[model samples]
Target: MNDILFRHNRPDRAATFEEYRAEGGFQALQKALADLSPDAVQQTVIDSGLRGRGGAGFPTGKKWSFVPRNLPGPRYLICNCDEMEPGTYKDRVLLERNPYLLVEGMALACYALGVERAFIFIRRGYELAALNLKGAIAQTHKAGFLGSAICGSGFNLELDVHQSAGRYICGEETALMNALEGIRANPRSKPPFPAVKGLWGQPTVVNNVETLSNIPAIVAHGPAWFKALAATPEGAGTKLFCVSGHVQSPLCLELPIGTTLGEIIDTHCNGMRTGSTFKACIPGGASTPYFTKDHWTVPLDFDPVAKAGSRLGTGGIVVFDQSTCMVAATLNLVRFFARESCGWCTPCREGLPFVQHTLERIESGRGDLADIDILREHVHKLNYAFCALAPGAMGPVEGLLRLFEDEVREHITGGKCPVKG
Candidate 1:
């Protein structure tokens, strides 16, 4: 139970700056500024094997390394706090409980990446989290941990919180940059990737809140200690899991990486709710495929979850009971994604609605066997969409067609939802 993130979290309210510093908060920043070189800081994280916790699980240090050292002009660091994924709220919880962690982590990141400017692009409706962060930033500035010549190390950094106007697509890095720039928030194409050309065509490294928040600990404790915190050999660090739906205790908690799905449900969640039997779950967020009882023993890490036919997306575990209708559930998810589509491309803009329509028809008993094939077809077609939106939107549908095809078939065959009946 080596809780790296939540060790200092208070139960009732956010830990204040004074409390955080008293518990050794900015020591890592001081250590980095005083001793470690930028390259050394980056290398420590690289050795720690810390991957991005923001769905993709990309290597954090490697991502930082992408910024060309010799590139001209100012490089930027953005902590992506846009936790808009369905069933995902770890970022909000983390920020609400301890904003100082992020502040220190960002300063350390700024030092490591040669970034003088940084922004925390938070989603709308997280007012409390944003307010707390603003307070934390001001406190850090007054304490001389932030603002020009921080810690008397001659390292200058300015950090700000930019609350977004609210759009699911803003969670995507390119779209986020556009939104931050006061543009339309449409995702720009890659190849001129963000590390090289981002936020008005400058080298920018965008890390998730949880991802950056680990920097301070990684620097303070060394890579070996961080790597040893995982439950599995391959897993390098702890993960924040947001468990919701049909559980005795639905909560956001931190646990070692590679904890089994079965352990999380049966032990941590205290099993299903009274009189409810486990049917299935979205192992990660809504964007991932489903996990049935048969896959309970599967490790809930990036590679293992992917190998088990689902992505460990955002570590958002949404459970469903036997009484739940997989068809209706998937339809609900599709509806949200379709409504949230940026209309940037045809597949996500057009195909998602079509898939939604197809699912509706099946759920309402107006569908045939042919509609099933259509859903299958759109799942593949949407995967080729301009961005991850269309493909992510198709996730539940793909899982429905793959894991619960029988339920869909029953709806069509019985002329109604069997579960509803």
Candidate 2:
């Protein structure tokens, strides 16, 4: 009953094109192409208060407006589908179940942003989802909704799904652009911002898959309707939460944005699993800080979660039971980052391994009070790395330092892991 982006996603399989149409899937695209001016379309999204679902939570409409009007040559729009973050897989679900959502959403965004060439920079591991998107694009083209004169609106467009080299750095916008150009996927410096110079140095707008996917709904339902979908008055629309770990049912459910974390656990997941009790959770994705029981009641939205001390990243909620050691959990995540570092800068290249080593030592009972202080110092140091990767890697570590210092002290005091015991 609860639906929007996932309205047509049946439990057995993905909805067919005909089924999607029956539910008024393409109607939003038709409305935008037929009635609304580009500015009007952008304005609708602005009024709807739709924020990006791909972690940053930036306003989607405002990002579209950043492209200079009628800029010469070709402007580009990229749907960032490189879902490599640990504890995050929401975009893969959307693409797998309803590929048209992304196709239509990207098309709608192209109209608003004057983008003729669009790319879905996807992670290579999502083979099925990528195939589905390719199929969806073909379907739209055959129906005269893609290629030239889309929906008879004279908005000629071409879409492509470009497979990535399977690197975590490609999730970063500038790094993605570099990867698209067949260059090494290193983070680019900001200030020229993609809206000004991107995708072969032309004006471009890059959006997360979920961010672009919200466009069609905003155009179809009106801004007020979109805003009303969120559980909270200030938020807009439902968020697809990818839940995992220690729950009775670890599922990706579309709950109204701002639904309390406790509600997600109790209602959708049916609470914690047998023999396990909730101890902490990564309120958003793996890159977000951990939330202890104190945050169970916190609204799982951007601002509220941020206010509660973590970014609402990717809306991927990974829980840890009381049996889990925060030190060990954080070390695993940091090690992944260490291996994934693009070797772009010294801090990330050198510091992440050090961070991992510190956590490993702490978990192995070799750490002292001095090691704890150094861990805290590394958290601050990594934040200044060349890209968000190292900083994001420190999220769980920061949480351990802040919330589990006592447990860390136990390792030092007992000369062994108390949690392991």
Candidate 3:
């Protein structure tokens, strides 16, 4: 079966509503509205095992069902379009090429979650995506597919595009909600989960752009059809793996979740550059652990990646060849984490710089072994701070220390960067 979601992403003008409808878009919406019950819709998604494609691979249907069905106030669905992770930019492609797919998906999710108002929280940096999405929103509203009495089904719905003042922390669900409500972007404590006390203290469901894009498909094809799309035992469905760095073909390729890292490199990506040996890859964006050449056999999925002591974060497969210095690579990643820190808590704000400085010192061959110990200690102390930022910041640092200690030692003993003059 042809993968429909990314099929329209080539560099021409994006498909508008009329073009999308001509290509069988919104048939799923009509089917969903006319045939499926909200509970049935939720159940179909659960059975499909469609995990969120965002950094956190939370189960999608389960996240939606968290909203109280009978509870009466307004419920909201927010599509998280803040794609700020380093080495990750697939969401931008999705939003830019097929804004309607995301809108259709969000509308379907709103139907499933008993939500009437939905917002696509787009990042300000993505000016094109923001503009495209706003135009799509207007089209959706005018076509009777959105707004009051949608599709003549008497199901009133409203979809809006809200631009976020580009901040990495705003990608977090709670922080996204807080920002939506005109507050500073900071993560709210859980327990009174967003399903309960969310945006304006009402039920809210915040899903990643890719996650919401799967909803219309799930509703169109029954759960079994969607489940059979995956080539792995973990689940079904094709995923967009955005590969970058040192690879012969660096682009976003859609493959089944069970596709091996080696297949992706050798087949889709045309392997690492001709002279470069594949030293390692961060299987899933910046937060995942470094997978050595030995892990080429590991399947690319949430459970398998985690079983191998890493995660399939955002499905960003960043390749590193032999010429890349591990010490310098680690320093660069640490710098990203430090700079993106939201300053909401002390650990992320204060500790990240400390970690970055220590890593730079050790990598530059001007530090003691005690620096490694301090790095480890501070990572542990800082990781559990207020949000996922600090914890996520530890990923590359931990992997660098654990997987390439000898490389660090080599740099230290040799008194300079191994890859540099």
**Which candidate number would show the highest lDDT if scored against the true structure?**
1
Overlapping backbone residue pairs in candidate 2 total 0
Estimate the TM-score for candidate 1: 0.99
Model 2, span 1-421: residue lDDT tens: 3478888887867777888888888898898889989889889989999999988899988887888876689999999999999989999999889998888888888888888889999999899899989988998888888898888788988999999989998999999999999998898998789999998989989899888888788888899988989888789998999999999999898889999999999888999999899999998888888999999888888999999889998999999999998888999899999999999999999999998898888899888789988988998999899888988999888998899999999988888899996
Q: If candidate 2 were superposed on the true structure by all CA atoms, what would the RMSD be?
A: 1.0
Q: Give per-residue lDDT, candidate 3, residue 404.
A: 89
Q: Name model 3 segments beyond 4 Å from true.
A: 9-11
Output the number of the TM-score-best candidate: 1
Per residue, candidate 3 scores C-alpha lDDT tens digits across 343-365 of 88988899999888887887778
lDDT of 1 by residue, 1-421 (tens): 7788997899999999889999999999999889989899999999999999999999999999999989889999999999889999999999999999999999988898999999999989999999999999999999999999888888999998999999999999999999999999989999899999998899999999999889899999999999999988898989999999999999998999999989998899999999999999998888988999989999888999988889998999999999899999999999999999999888888888888888999998888988989899998989898889888888888889999999999999998999987
Better of 1 and 2 by lDDT: 1
Q: How well does candidate 2 score on lDDT at residue 188?
A: 91
TM-score head-to-head 1 vs 2, winner: 1
Q: What is the C-alpha lDDT of each candidate?
A: 0.92, 0.90, 0.85
Worst 10 residues of 3 by lDDT: 1-10
Q: List the pairs of residues colliding in candidate 1.
A: none
Q: lDDT for model 3, please.
A: 0.85
Against the hidden reference, what TM-scores do the models get? Answer: 0.99, 0.98, 0.97
- Per-model tally of clashing residue pairs: 0, 0, 2
